[model samples]
Target: MRTIHTTSEEETCEAGKIIAAELRVGDVVLIDGPLGAGKTAFVRGLAEGLGADPRNVSSPTFTILQQYRGSMPLYHADLYRLAPAEVADLGLEETGLDGILAVEWPDRWTARPTVAYLVVIDDQGGDDRRIRIRR
Candidate 1:
């Protein structure tokens, strides 16, 4: 487990890029944070680090899932607007089989991968944030 602190969105993104270096295909990352905790910003960094266009990354809250082709692939999911029971229909684990999976609002996912990295972000007011990564 590791903890990182950031005072701006850019720093938060950098933290995500740092974590991306340690990821591999078939890996799941569960991200838990408040609505404005910079979860999407962190994912943008992930996309950039993985050779994808960061500008193409966006919150998938309405779309449910978005796939990006990077050095490998990135399957990003947001369950913010979905009911917990609806999560299974997406088959997230299989969707991310060929790449890394990053899920926001993962607590709504009852069948989330047991072996996965957990990222918790706490908003410390203004642009500051405290991010904790656990395996």
Candidate 2:
């Protein structure tokens, strides 16, 4: 595990870019953070690093999931509004079958990937965020 303190949005996004550089196809990343945390910004950076257009990445909170193509494919999912019982209906695990699945509010899901990367972001009361990454 590695922990990083990001003082601003740019730093938070950079952290995501760093992670993206190391990602592989079929990777599942569990992301947990509160509202207004930089999860979406992080995903934007990740999209850029993976050779996709960062401007197109957004929180899939309402839509549930969004897909983008780059060096590989990226499947971003938001579980913030879903309950564990509803997760299976979405078949989210299959997101890893063809792309990198970055799931926000992953705790709402009952099952986890056998192997997964994780990123936890905590807002530190201001422009700062505590970001932890683990595999």
Candidate 3:
């Protein structure tokens, strides 16, 4: 595991970009963070790094999941509102074959991807955040 500190939203996004560069198709990124913890900000940078518009990236908390085309596809999923049993109906496995999956609140899911990158964001109070990454 590794840790990074970000004092601003841009820095958080920049950290996401760094992480994104290391991603490949079939990669799964598991993110555990509280609301306002900059999870979406990280995804925006990830989308940007993959050649997609960062502005187009948003939390899929309401819609469940979203796909963005880039150098490769980005499958962003949010399981905040889902129950464990309902997670399977989303057909998340199919997304893994064709794009990178970045899942928020992955702890809610009973099954996880075979190979996943674990990222935990800890709010350091104010605007600072500590992002911990592991694979």
Candidate 2 C-alpha lDDT tens digits along 46-115: 8888989988888764689888889899888888888899987898866668768988888888886858
Candidate 1 lowest-lDDT run of ten: 54-63
Question: Per lDDT, what order, best first?
Answer: 1, 3, 2
Compose the digit string of candidate 1's lDDT tens values, residues 76-123.
Answer: 898999888899788875888888899999998999987999999999
- Residue 59's lDDT within candidate 3 is 71
The per-residue C-alpha lDDT of model 3 at residue 75 equals: 87
Q: Candidate 3, clashing residue pairs?
A: none
Each model's C-alpha lDDT? 0.90, 0.87, 0.89
Q: Candidate 3, overall lDDT?
A: 0.89
How much is 117 displaced in model 3, in angstroms? Answer: 0.6
Q: How accurate locally is residue 70 in candidate 1, as Cα lDDT from 0 to 100? A: 96
Largest TM-score belongs to which candidate? 1
Give candidate 1's TM-score.
Answer: 0.97
Better of 1 and 3 by TM-score: 1
Clashing pairs in 1: none
- Candidate 3 per-residue lDDT, tens place, 27-127, comes to 99988899989998988888999998898888764799988889999988989999988998888877757879999889877778757998899999999
TM-score of 2: 0.94
